[model samples]
Target: MNITLAQAEKAIATAKEKAKAIDAKMNITVVDAGANLVAFGRMDGAWLGSLDISIKKAKTARYFDMNTGIVGELSQPGGSLYNIEHSNGGLITFPGGVPIKNTKGEIIGAIGVSGSSVDNDHTVAEAGSKAI
Candidate 1:
């Protein structure tokens, strides 16, 4: 099953609303289950550096089928799956990434956001996921 553009648009819209509410510019990325890009958006004043990081976070979520924050924990110094992150093109491991699960509880995609604090990023991504 493929993720529809409409779903991606909904997620982006939700993210934009949340980011605006917090007065923070943001870079947002959405990826399919295979980690392919679905959609992207950057607020007017978002940092350029966040573009790549946001995409990487979504890819990381798709690759692991889990949130990037959990991936970070697993890839940490003493964690069991530490070295796997290095093999997947070195995706960013952080909390800004979240899986988009279908009603069946299957992950259909993921969302990622950057250009703000980690907490804000997570908030935006969560809002996007709920919108979808």
Candidate 2:
């Protein structure tokens, strides 16, 4: 199932809170199960460049139904998914992307955060995903 607009908004709000807690200005993107943009937020002073990265991260997570960091892991040199980022237009095969699952444990969408360190990005994304 896809994420509802309400759920998407909640995700963004939670992500923003986490970003603020970490003193990070972030570009956050949430995409539905079909990998369509559902919501987005760019905190003041956030990097313009990171906007696209956030969107790609969300899509990458939904496209694979897994955290983008996991994809990054397998895409390392000599790994099974090496060079996989080159496919599907382009992918941010790094931290900051996470799948959003419903109470039923079914993936509904994904959240992506950028404009900070990967660890902070992932943390924010995790916070957002858990909102639902």
Candidate 3:
């Protein structure tokens, strides 16, 4: 199932809260199960460059139905997924991407956050995903 606009807004709201809690200005993005953009939020003072990065991160997560960090690990030198990022028109294989799952544990969408450290980005994205 795809993520509805309401759900996407909820995710963005939650991600914004987490970003504020950590004193991070973030660009948050959400995508449906089909890897289509659903909603986005850019906090005041957030890095302009991170806007695209956030969107790519969410799309990347939905594309693989897994965290981008995991993708990053597998894409390391000599790893099985090495060079995978080069495919898909470029992907952010680092942190800040998380799949959004429903109560039935079905992945419905994904959330991605940027403009902070990788750890913080992941944390915020995780918070957003859980909101769904």
Off by over 4 Å in 1: none
Candidate 3 C-alpha lDDT tens digits along 43-108 = 999999999999999999999999999999999999999889887788998999999999899999
TM-score, one value per model: 0.93, 0.98, 0.98
Pitting candidate 1 against candidate 3, the one with the higher TM-score is: 3
* Backbone clashes under 3 angstroms, per model: 0, 0, 0
Q: After superposition, how far is residue 64 of candidate 3 from its true place, in Å?
A: 0.6
Q: For residue 95, what is the lDDT in candidate 3? A: 99
Best by lDDT: 2
The residue-level lDDT of candidate 2 at 84 comes to: 94
Q: Which candidate, 1 or 2, has the higher TM-score?
A: 2
- Which residue pairs come into collision in candidate 3? none
The lowest-lDDT stretch of 10 consecutive residues in candidate 2 is: 80-89
Residue pairs in collision within model 2: none
